[model samples]
Target: MTSAILVSILMTLVAASTPILLAALGELVVEKSGVLNLGVEGMMLCGAVAGFAVAFSTGSTGLGLVAAAIAGIATAMVFAVLTLSLTANQVATGLALTIFGVGASSLIGAGFVGKTITRLGPVFPESLSGHPWLRAVFGHDIVVYLSLALVFGVGFFLRRTRAGLILRAVGENDASAHAIGYPVIAIRYGAIAFGGALAGLGGAYFSLALTPMWADRLTAGRGWIALALVVFAAWKPGRLLLGAYLFGAVMTLELQAKAAGVTWLAPELLATAPYLATIAVLTMMSLGRKTGRLDAPACLGKPFSAS
Candidate 1:
C-alpha cells in the first residue's frame, strides 16, 4: 500500500481501537476493585443511545458525551444496587443488565433510526490535523487522545498512588481492607460508577465518532471483546493498550479485505474476524492461566457485606 493508504489504515485502526480501549479500561478498574461486572455491553448500548439522542437534539457532541456518561452511571447504579446493596448474584445481575440495556436502548433509539449527525472533529487545528505527516498523531478526535492518556493515567493511578493501594487492597482482601477502616462497598460503588462512565464514553464514540449515527446495537459485540481484552492483558493497563490496538488491527484488516474484494477468504469468515479473535484470545489466556498464578483480583465475582 502507498503512504496515504497506510496512513488511512492506521487512522482506521486507531479509531476502531479507541472504544474497546475505553471500555476495557473502565472494566479493568472495576475488576481491580474486585467487581466482575459482566454488563459492559449493556452499559455501552445505553450510553450510545443517550449520547446520540442528546447530541442529535442539542447539536453538541460534548453534551451528548455527558449524557452518555450519566446514563451509564445510572445503568451501572442499577447493577450496583442489585449486586452490592441487595447482594444479588453478580453474574446473573450482569446478564440481566445487558438484556435491559438492549431493550432500553432500542426503545429510546427507535425514533432515531437512520438519523445522522455531524461527526466529532479532532481537537487540533486543521493545520496540524490535516498535515500529511502530523495527521496520524493529531487527526484523532478528543476521545482517541483521551483514551491514550487514560491508559497511562490509569497505570499510574494503580501503581503509584496511595488511593490506588487502597483500591488494590480492597480487591486483594476486602475483609482486611474493611478491618483497616476502609469502606469496602463504598469504594466498589465508586469503581462501578467510574466503569459505567467510561463504558458510556466508549459507546458514545460509536455514535459520535465512529459512525456518527444511531443504529440498533451499534456496538455489536465489542463490549465482550473488551471484557476478553482485560483477561488478554493480564489486567495491566499498558498491556490492555497493546491488546486493544492488536484487536483494532484485526478488525481493520477485515474491513480492508472487504473493501478490496479479496476472494481468498470467505466473506462470512472475514466478518467473524473480531469475534474469532476474541474467542482465540480468551482460549489462549485460559490455557496460560493453567500454568501460572491467576492475575485476577482475589475477590473478583465474590459478594461482600459488612454483616
Candidate 2:
C-alpha cells in the first residue's frame, strides 16, 4: 500500500512536469536563436483549445495534436511578423500575444466548458501500464516520454550540431551571424515556430492528459512558469528538467493536500505556492545577474532584421 501510494505521487509529478518541460525546451531553442517570446502563455492557450476542439470532434488524439501544433505555429507567426519583420518590441508583443491568447482561448473554449473526453493513455499495453510496480514508468501517456526524449534531443541539438552553433551565434550576436552569411531572420522564424509547436503540445497535454476536459484559463498561468523555467535552467536542457519537476512537485502538493483534506494549509496559500516558486526563480535570475552567473543569449529579446 505504501509503495502504491508512492507510485501514484510519482505519476502525478511526471504528469505535472511534462508540460512545463516541453514548453521550456521549445523556449530554450527560441532564446538560443535570440528571440524572447513571452507569448508562450497565449500560444499554449490557443493550442489547448485547438487540440481539444479537433480531438473532441474527430476523436483522434493524433489529429488533435497536429491541429494544436498548427495552431501554435500560426499564432507564433503573428509574433514573428511583428518582431522579426516589422521590428516591434519583442517584450511588448509577447505580452500582447498572451493577452490575445487568454481572451481568444476563453472565447473559443466557451463551447467546450464542462466537456470531458477520454484522457490520452499510455501507448503500451495494459500489461505494462497497469502493472502494480511498472505503472510509474509505463502508465503515462506518450507525451510524458516524448517530453523526456526532447530533453536529451534538445541538449544534443544545441550542444553538438553545427546548426545549433549558428543558432547560438545568432542569439549571441545576430549581426555577426548575418555578416557570416547566415539568415538571421529565417533561423529565428524557424525557432519561433518550433517553440510554438511545443508550447501547443504542452497545452494539449493539459486538456488531453492532465485534466481531460476544458475550462476557462485551463492552463492557469503554466506558460509563465514555463518561461521562468528557461531562466531557472540557465538555458540548459538538463537543468530545465529539474526545474520543471521541482515546480511540478510544488503544484502537486496543493492537489495532494486537498485530496487528503488537510485543513492546516489554506487553499489560497497552496494556490500561491507554484507562483511563489516562480518568483523565487526569477529573483534568483536577477541575483545571478549581479554575480555574473546569468548567461542568457546576448541578443535575446532584441529585434532582428536583414536590412
Candidate 3:
C-alpha cells in the first residue's frame, strides 16, 4: 500500500510539472539567445483563455491548441517589434507585454469563466499502458511526452548544432557576432516568438487538458516559477527537468496532504508550499553563486544597436 501510494505521488508530480517544463524549455532557448522575455505569465494566460474559447466553440482540442499557440505568437510579435526593432528596453517591454496579456485575456475570457470541456486523454499505445511501471512513468497526455522530448531536443541542439552555436555566440557577445555577419536582432526575434508559442502551448495544456476548464489567472504564477527554473537550472535544459519535477512534486504533495487529512500541517501552509519552495531555491542559488559560476549570456537583457 505504501509503495502504491508513493507511485501515485510520483505520477502526480510528473503530471503537474509538464506545463512548467514546456514553458521553461522555450524560455531557456530564448535566454540562450540573449533575449529576456518576462511576458511568459501573460502568454500562458492568453493561451489558456484562447485554447478554452476555441475548444469550446469548435469542440476540438487540437484546434484549441493551435489557436493558443497562434495567440501566444501574436502577442510575442508585439514584444519583438518593441524590443528588437524599436530597441525598447527588453525588461520594460516584457513587463508591459505581460500587463497587456493579463488585461486582454481577462476581457476575452470573461464569458468563459466556469465553463468546462471534455478533455482528450493520454495517447500512449495500449502495450505501453499495460505495463505497470511504464504506465506510471510514460503514460501521459501528448503534451507531457512532448515536453520531455523538448528537453532532450533542446539539450542536443545547444550542445551539437552549428545554428545553436551561432545563437550562443550571439548571446555571449552580440557585437562580435554582428561583426562576423550574424543577424542578432533577427535571431532574437525568432527565438522570442518560439518562446511565446511554447508558453502558449503550456497554457493551452492547462486549460484544454489538465483542468479542462476556464478560469481567470488559471496559470497562477506558473510562468514566474518557470522563469526561476531557468535560472535555477543555470540555463541547462537537463537540469530544468529536474527542477521542474521537484517543484511539481512539492505542489502535488501539498494537495495530497490536504486530501489525506494530515493534521500536523496548516492547510494554508500546505497550499503555499510550492511558492515557498521556489523562494527558498532562489535564495539559495543567490547565496551559492561563489561555488559555481552561473553562466548567463553576456548580452542578455541589453539593447543592441546595429551599426
Best by lDDT: 1
**Model 3 Cα lDDT, one tens digit per residue, 188-218:** 8888888998999988888988788988788
The RMSD (Cα, Å) of candidate 1 is 1.1
- Please, what are the lDDT tens digits per residue for candidate 1 over residues 1-307? 4888889999999999999999999999999999999999999999999999999999999999999999999999999999999999999999999999999999999999999989999999999999886889988899998899999999999999999989999998999999999999999999999999999999999999999999998999998899999999999999999999999999999999999999999999898999999999888888877655459889999999999
- TM-score (C-alpha, index-matched) for candidate 3: 0.95
- In angstroms, give how far residue 105 of model 2 lies from its true place: 1.0
Tell me the lDDT of model 1 at 186.
Answer: 97
- Residue-level lDDT of model 2, residues 1-307, one tens digit each, is 9999999999999999998888888999999999999999999999999999999999888888899889999999999999999999999999999999999999999999987788887988999999987999889888888899999998998999998898899999999999999999999999999999999999999988888888878899999999999988899999999999999899888889989988888888778889988998899778767655487899989787777
Answer with 2 or 3, whichever has the higher lDDT: 2
Looking at model 1, report the run of 10 residues with the lowest lDDT sum.
285-294
lDDT of 1 at 20: 98
Worst 10 residues of 2 by lDDT: 284-293
Give model 2's TM-score versus the native structure.
0.97
Candidate 1 vs candidate 2: the lDDT winner is: 1
lDDT score at residue 16, model 2, on the 0-100 scale:
93
